[model samples]
Target: MRFSLLLMVCALCSVSQAALTFILGAHENVCFGVFTDQPRTSISYYFAVQSGGAFDVDYTIKNPRGEVIVTEDKQRQGDFIINADIAGEYELCFSNSMSTYAEKVIDFEIKVENDKNDFKANMPDQPNAKPKAHIENMGKTVDKIDQKLDELLRAIQYYKTRNNRNQATVKSTESRIYYFSIFEVLLMVGMAGLQITVVQLFFKGSRKQLV
Candidate 1:
């Protein structure tokens, strides 16, 4: 039963979906192009800067006509769904040019679904009213379930990203603290040695003067 449910989830979620995690070097910009031959398709794009510098990046989305559909500057994460009214290639871009030395880890996903066609194909004309109603009801139920599953999947991704970022931060902090403590200890030891040397010199000079 669990295996079947997992399969169902995969089938529902695998509609032209791309999930990726990659490092964007400083002063580098990358763009991904998605081609859709059919018009009126739904496109879902999501991105998050997992770690680095300010945990932000510049991003832009453009239509096939070379027109900007959406653009953002120094953003940490975003989730957007836009309709592709014109059938062609769409571009999604990410830029890390703001950071000169730090590299950013980004997690993103893009999904394209022909929502209208899929629904219409699934629901066909039935001569028997009872069967038609039953089929329609089943389709609705399936759609609802699919939507809930998608939401759950997105939530899981979000938490996973957050966990990775937090872990990185904790490790960085630990390293800094460890090095700082060592430096502090060495400074204290050096100060003590200098004081001892000065005291010995003062005593020697006083003895010489007494003699």
Candidate 2:
């Protein structure tokens, strides 16, 4: 009975450790990759100046497409709240983009939070999780390559979507200009006819006086 209870406790701990964390040194940037069967619900983040930070920092979140989802500037240590409507692995970036000449040590924390308590509870108990790693560095390399390829595909799709929207906007603007030019030409013709009628009326009055 005790052994069964011990296994359950370990399983719970493993579920929590499933999250990944990273630290960025001063003037340094990094990328993180994520794999999830369930959708990610939120990004819980924190930032601090481990040393020599009297100024603010700039940070942003990027999707695989290199599109920025969220940004914060002149920010200090605090909790920034966010929600992802779609569930996938996302990137959190801290930029020294605004750091002054002085090399400042900035510390940031990121946790990929998922709120699937119901799903986690229903997770099949892994009684045989025996350090699942092989000596194949080649396999790891191949896996990394595959992951990169997937990201590239997603990025291309995102940019293509944006390009299509821009093209649509240009076409709409062209249509509007084309219509406006026609309208302006018609208005000018009407004004010219009005001027000719006024001149003829003025001459008829002089002819009647001569008669």
Question: By lDDT, who's the top model here?
Answer: 1
Model 2 pairs in collision: none
The TM-score leader among the candidates is 1
Candidate 2 residue spans exceeding 4 A from truth: 1-35, 120-211
lDDT of 2 by residue, 91-124 (tens): 6555554544534444444444456454445656
> Residue 172 in candidate 2 has what lDDT?
75
The weakest ten consecutive residues by lDDT in model 2 span: 1-10
Shift of residue 82 alpha carbon in model 2, Å: 3.2
Cα displacement (Å) at residue 211, model 1: 4.1
TM-score of each: 0.82, 0.40
Number of clashing residue pairs, candidate 1: 0
